[model samples]
Target: MFQDISCLEEIPIPDSLQPTIFIQNSLIKLVKNECVDKFCRIILESEQYKTKIIVEKLAEELVILSQIRQNRFHLISRICQNLFSESYYKEQLRPLLLRRIFRESSYYLLLCLYNDQIYSQNDIMNLILEQKRSDFAMYFAPEFGLIDTSIMIPKQWVKKVIKHLSDYQANDWALFKEYRTLGWLPNSIVAAIKKDDLDALLDFEVDSRFNINNFIEASPLEPFRLPRVNTYMSLAAIFGSINCFKLFYQSDIPVTDRIMHSAIAGGNYEIVRICARSVCDGFEAAIEYRQNEIMDWLLQNSLCKISSAVCMDWNNLLAALYLSDKTETNEILIKGMNEIYEGKAIAMPEIVSSSSNYF
Candidate 1:
């Protein structure tokens, strides 16, 4: 009967008694096909052998099978998890086998691997916290079923990753809809925009723009917490970059980039005009900070041809209005007044005091 066993289409293990030579030999081929579900069941139930085989050997094989079939390996992973834990009962498996299993998994898989066990759990957690969105998710999702099966991870971890992913792409070129769709985006990103580290936010926002609808419509980055309103504006203004006009107009998100911060701080400039209608609620803060760039963007436009100032003579007007130690404010002021007289902005205001005189 044993001689003809290999000839069967799908091998069957018969265990009325313990440890059949036939099943033991076939273990190699059977595990490759996710047949371990049945094999494991047999091992636990049988009275066949006084000594059971080591679990690591089984786990090693399952890991190999998982890599080979890949797409359908969840079954193998489940089996591996079961076997790894079960093998500990014997304390007989190779030490390398356990470490190898953890290393092979992606972020989500590794996380699950670490969730319970105290030995390697902390190391795995540190890796998870350090990983970025695209790399982290793709690396681990396949092995751990991180993105596929929603049932495994708790709500808290899922939310944390989502938030971090959004912040990662905050400066990316993808549209809001596209960014929002990625598995990694989180609500904490928005909260960060509200009150995050001003210096960091300003530095990061330097080249980025807000193209979404009024800031309110734009989604938030999650997980990161906010600071006070004053701190939010001060640093963002000093370092914010030049972005689309609509961003200033539509910026209701409460955080202003450095350019706008400067414009608002300086007073009466096109930058201010751009932000005057913005959805962001902190223009008053811009005034408090004495954003010269913002003030110049607003006032300089009024000084040039109304239609041509921020639109046509942007460079020339901005150059004339944005002053440094050598740029002689009175000279630019005179030049601006003449331009205003010629174009006659609806109503250009007199030069405000130096932004530095106040906040």
Candidate 2:
């Protein structure tokens, strides 16, 4: 009967009985095909001390099969989790098999390999934190059904997870969407913008859970919990992302002098314009930075005037003003120079003539 077993189209391994020799020998080929579900079920139902020894020997091959057929391997992962629950397996098989699986498997398989006993979630968390792979941690959540699943990672751990992942560069929008959909803190939004991920920003604006009213009401870089408003604005300006600055500006966060200067220095014209309409006290800094484009915009839009003091500081100031055909440019320069010379005359010490005093 065993000799002709290989000849059959589908091997009938009953769930009631332990795996036969033929079944064990043909496990690899069977796992690659439709027999995977039945084979995994048999192994899961059987004694781990027996089946685990067989599975451990075929660990590498099983991982490869799982990679090829993820759905099939997901069943295997579930079984591993189940087996890991038993104290005997926890004390014995976990070290022999699951430990190796954690190192060898990808996110999906590793998720299935998750046994909250032998290694707490924090242990894995520490491993990734120690390895500095926290940026990619979000990748594992979906495979574990954490994202969009009914299961909720408690709020405390969620904060820790969010904080760690926020420090890392996240390019996965699905992970980002999950963060938003889950109503996790928007600690990573600034990081996303700094990465110039416009799509992520766009997604945030549209996500139903995104509370724009609350966001706008909070101080600039509110989630940062530090003095990072300048850092926040600088990135938006440097990237020349008008949409980014709009987020802050619309939030009623006072666009500071440093922000305007940075926007001008970065040649972010739209940001400059957005900032110009507000209190722009960085005109001198803009001039210092040689941001002629910004100066031109400021002058052309009457956002700033070339004061007498500014004229005295600039060389050939008259020629610079004469270059613009704003007609009023010449008048402003002439008036400023007149004010300076008149002020100088008024401040000069008067010389009393002795002849006039004698007469």
Candidate 3:
């Protein structure tokens, strides 16, 4: 009898023949066979089977079977994915599946449903905070347009979201503005700096809480090392924001060699000129980025010498030089390599020959 019942799934029954009794019996057999596809097709095709009682019963059976079957999560999640297309099924199944899945700690399933737009913003936020899943909450909330509810999120999470937005180079002004209003002043400033939003940075400056000089002087490494206000002077250089660089430089933010390297890599001659007087050397950065103009300027201005003993990563620089066919730049690099060999007692030919292997 069960074999005959299971065979019924292969043939599409007429709509009039799809009574509730047939569907209920077939569903039990299908669940036994793990025929998730046919089970969903029967539910979706039959309007009568979409009722609350039927879906609730299916959910119960799946929950029970999931405990017994090792791959029950995958099977049930696949069923949910199929059922999500119908509005009525989506509404009915979401809560039932979420309740069962959440209880089982099947977070990947929860995330799949969340991505499918199963959870409302409030539902996810409450779920995340209650479970203390701040990592998931910080990234997921902003992406789902839940920035307005950021106040309810912890300060640390807010900082993390700000850093996330900044790192990904997302330009959500509404989100940034909200964070700024919440007294996460320093983090917002660093985000603005990293994003090269001078106007937004200036707007942040007007607030009495914003002590521009003091803010520049202080460097907090809480969120991550990259988004700190002091260390991010290189951001302006790399982004080719001369005005922003001027703003940071005038504030007496110390110009490190990294900043000069970033300026060289960015190929902005003006910012490079500004950083040239301050930083010790940018020879490797110029060669690596193939910034011929900056390379020439550095050498002509005597800002960086080929004879400098601090030629860190000579193989990388040599590879860059070998790849660059520019006669003038190659001459400078070859001379620099010779100078390194003469001064530092390092062999040049073997390193030069091996440099091509980097490609």
Per-residue alpha-carbon lDDT of candidate 1 for residues 210-301, written as tens digits (9 for 90 to 100): 33322222112211111223332332232232333323334554434543444344332444455444423333332233222332333433
Worst 10 residues of 1 by lDDT: 217-226
The residue-by-residue lDDT of candidate 2 on 191-227, one tens digit each, is 5564556678777768787653332211221111122
Assess candidate 1 and give its lDDT: 0.36
TM-score of 1: 0.26
Better of 1 and 2 by TM-score: 2
Clashing pairs in 2: none
| Model 3 TM-score (2 dp) | 0.34
Ranking 2 against 3 by lDDT, winner:
3
Each prediction's TM-score versus the true structure: 0.26, 0.29, 0.34
Off by over 4 Å in 2: 1-55, 95-98, 112-120, 129-359
Best by lDDT: 3
Whole-model lDDT, candidate 3? 0.54
Among all windows of 10 consecutive residues in model 3, the one with the lowest summed lDDT is 218-227
Q: Between the candidate structures 1 and 3, which one is better when assessed by TM-score?
A: 3
